[model samples]
Target: MTLDLIYSTALLLALSALYEFNIRAWGQRLFAAQVCAGLIFGAICIFGMLHPANLAPGVIFDARSVILGVAGIFGGPVVAVIAGLMAGAYRLWLGGAGALVGAAVVTTSVLFGLGMRVALRRGWAQPRLLDFLMFGAMLHIAALGWFLLLPMQHLQKLLETLAFPYLFVLTPSTALLALLLNDLQEQRHAKQALARSEAMRRAITRASPDLLFVLDEDGRYLEVVSPEEHLLYRPLTETLGKRMDETLPPAEARRFQDFLLQTLKAGTPQKIEYELDTLGGRHVFEGRSQALDIRVDGKRAVVFVARDITERVKAEQDRRVAAVAFESRQAMLVSDAGTVILRVNQAFVDLMGYSREEMIGRKTSTLRSGRHDAAFYEAMWESVRKTGKWEGEIWDQRKGGDLVPLWTTITAVRDAHGAVTHYVATMNDISERKLQEEEIRSIAFYDPLTALPNRRLLLERLQRALTLARRNGQHGALLFVDVDNFKQINDEHGHHAGDLLLQEIGSRLGRVVRESDTVARIGGDEFVLVLEHLNEDPALARTEARQIAAKALLTMARPYDLEGLVYHASGSIGIAMFNQAEVDLDLLMRQADEAMYQAKHAGKNTVHMHGG
Candidate 1:
């Protein structure tokens, strides 16, 4: 083969390979269309080679424009430009005048491809028929410009034979085809979006905690979504499509129907409270209805959405009833201004042993025991007004002129603006508890045998005396005394004789000490004396301690005549003085105990100072 023929064959093969590569790179769907177009064009070129005709010399058809436009509209502009370059190179290798025509085809194809890509990216192309027409017009204009650059004689023949038909007939037909394809794709996407939205709505309705139902204007149930269907004692599927009266009791159905009708008539929304007698007993519901303009059988109709608020409604009713009963039956009272009683229940009158005529319009102070002063009332009211409630024990006076104790709670009622409206007081009688408390106090602090101060009481009085002496720059004394040989009387003459001797000693000490002093029996044979208001002289404390110790020892030495028995006792005394040197009660007590040990160690029946 000659060099020219070899170049033409190589060029044809190269174009075919380039087209295949573009197709594969873009995807099989796009590549298939371009390959099909190329096959058809190649067959036409072979047919022209076999049967050549001598006719008017002009460009008969421009397959380049057709292929490029198709690629641009379908696979986009980049593919078209690639195809155009391959076509131009193949025609040039053929070494004919058609090469120039091929160059024009290449230029027009690139412009059409790039322009369409820009328009599409910018959203300038409409999605419908207008987009098709605009795109076709742009391609034809590019083709016309390419044809103008051709030789004059050939261009004139092309306009007459090829340009008119391609612009007016072929371009519009191609646009119509593209439009149909777009419409199909849009329909598919719309169907998918609608399906997703419907599935989401169904999921939400099924999982809701409340009983949700849709009703028509005539009160027929269209749908019901409820998790607690067993509580209603009816399958939700069975209840659907039935009238409200058919599925519900007559009374409940009537109330629901009325609410729906009212909502439809008003063209707005309404709420109605009603009760349902289901298998779970009485369940309350607050039915809320809103008018919905829904399409049924291609005609407009109203639908209502009713939600069950059974738990909330029942709780509200129970609270209201309990509040009213509590205010009416219990010993409830309300104060209007600054503890002034404005209202009192009959239970309060009976509890305080007072008539209603005597209690109303009276200040709370009328019941006060005078044990707590005005500051006590102020503190109680402060807590009530701040926190709205206070509860504890309180003391008051009864109508019969006796003090009564009660466990009382006071609460402040406030208005919407947060201003105090009234004070509510509730109380229960606790007089018996107060009496028991007093008896326990006496037992804890006093000695039952001697009717005098016990250890606990003595410690308290001694601490007080020390504090007074420190404040006044005076002195006090604590004397710890023990009977020296009282155990012998119990061992020799029996325990009865020892008890008689101790009683006699206690009597003698009480007679010797002043009324202000405290004489305490800490044990069977031990006693403590707390003497206050002493002179600053240390000798005075010692002198008083010695005098008490002498009186106790002398009283014990005399024989106790108990049921014809004789008993004698002596006492060793330890004295501790409280002055400016002593800082606390514990240290003073320790000093007194040490002194008593020293007295016992020195000898029997003697007194010892803490320093001595």
Candidate 2:
């Protein structure tokens, strides 16, 4: 019985080793692990029963209760139920006087283990050495009660002989199994915690925008982690274990090594600005370094974080250039898309006579002169919107309430999406240019002495009148007037008297004709008049010309006072009428001149009609 008991106890210990090293290594699925544990526990229980410490024929005792009970305590309800049914069914199938008793013992041991598990979970009992020992003791005590089912003759002998051995061997085995399971639970928890911490570290490094590096005291790259790989000096695999002098220019590498040594000696954080020609392009970087407490490859190390500032540096340079250009001599103003003034250069302030503070935040319409109506501004802005530019003359008011004409060009500033973001306007004061242009127009198309249309202007109006006469079926007349004895008056009263007589004659001719007619001084003493929109008939047009000629002849015969000297001058007039645009312009002028000569031959201070 002692040797059989050793064999049974040794089998259960082997099962305990399998549970420790083999079953638990299947990993962390609790239900699947417990089901596998249940199958193993049931198999161990059957093997133990087959080699039981036999007291009598068809009556047995071994470690079946120990296996099922431990499965209940550690594997919870699933393992306990599965293992108990298997062992209990096998025991009942082995028809014997102890079969019922063995089955009852199986149920009682399983129930006690499950009850203790509930105690541990609810904090009614702690899973300590004392609790597990007491649990094993109490479970065996209950299993002893199932021995009453044995035949009364065998039951007393079995209890007296085997009860002590069951308690001695299986109780400590149960406690040892619980201790093993507890240790495995702690190990699993620690491994999961370490895995989660490692995953978090990797996630943070992958998401960082800057390049992270570990460099040894000798300036060799120990490790590199770059989220933007293109910004790196080289690929990570090629860069590791490479010295700074191998990747950078000699001067730059020396500067970097000096800063690294300084950081390590100080044992504190250091900062630097540097440049590197990288895979992408030349880049400017700002680096921050902290000395590490550990070593890499037997040398002290540092954690260096580099942030690329290439675009930022370029933008700063561009901003400085734009600042200088914006303060130029040309008057320039910038406004938002809503026409609210944003910025104005010094030249703009001087030109508009408004202080920068007064103009900023105010609408551009605040400087409007009101000479242009709303429709004019709308058209100007429409051109700017469609073509992105508008240039014309505009009148803007000064601070003193005087209108200043500006030759202004407005250009729309747009963003990358082609949306107008602001408007930049350049202006030049054109007041002096306007005055010069008016003087030029007077000299080009008008007589300087009399301020009347000159011969050049007269011919243009005569051609236009001819065009109107043909279109409207109207006849136009041209009158040629001559000062009678004008050369004799000039020889008697000097040239000043002749000039005054010509000026008075020009005024008198204007009064005798309609406003639409053209009166011009073509030569020294000759004048021509063009009347438009006259009667359609030839005789009626001649009568109209005769009446106007008679009026002008009488007015010119009136005396003129030349510098306090009363001077008398008379005029002879001739008329030529035409109703067709096909009439030759030079031929028509000759006809009027011939008629005037005939008038002079007829009598002085009289009028004559051509072909009369």
Instruction: Give the per-residue lDDT of model 2 (tens digit) for 1-612.
Output: 756876787778777666655445677676677787787788888888889988778788888877777778777788888889989999999968788888998998788878887888899988788888888888888887777667788878877888788787778877777777777766766877898898997788888878898899989998888988788888777888899888767998899899999999999899999888888889999999999998877789999999889988999998898778779888889999999999999998889899999999999999899999999999999999999999999999999999999999999999989999999999999999988998998898889888889999999999999888888989999899998888987888899888888888898888889999999998888899998888888788888888889888889988888888798888888888889658999999999999899999998789988889
TM-score (all chains, Cα) for each model: 0.48, 0.71
lDDT, candidate 2, at 524: 86
Error of 2 at 126 (Å): 9.1
Cα error, residue 213 of model 1, in Å, equals 3.0
The whole-model lDDT of each prediction reads: 0.67, 0.86
lDDT of 1 by residue, 1-612 (tens): 123222333333334334334444544375565555444334423332223221134333433454455445544544554555566555555434445755676567556655665776688766566666767776776667765766777677666655665566436543654564355445545765787888998788777655677777667777677767754636777688898888887887887777777877787777766666766667766556667676555432344444566767767788798567656646878788577888787778888888777777888778888878888878887888688888888888888888778889998878879988878888888778878887787789877666667899998898888778888888788888888877788888888777777777777778767788888888888888887877788787667667776776676567767778755567777888887565678887788878887888888787787876
Count of clashes, each model: 0, 0
**Worst lDDT window (10 residues) for model 2?**
16-25
Which portions of model 1 show Cα errors greater than 4 Å? 1-131, 147-157, 185-189, 227-233, 277-282, 298-300, 314-432, 440-547, 551-612
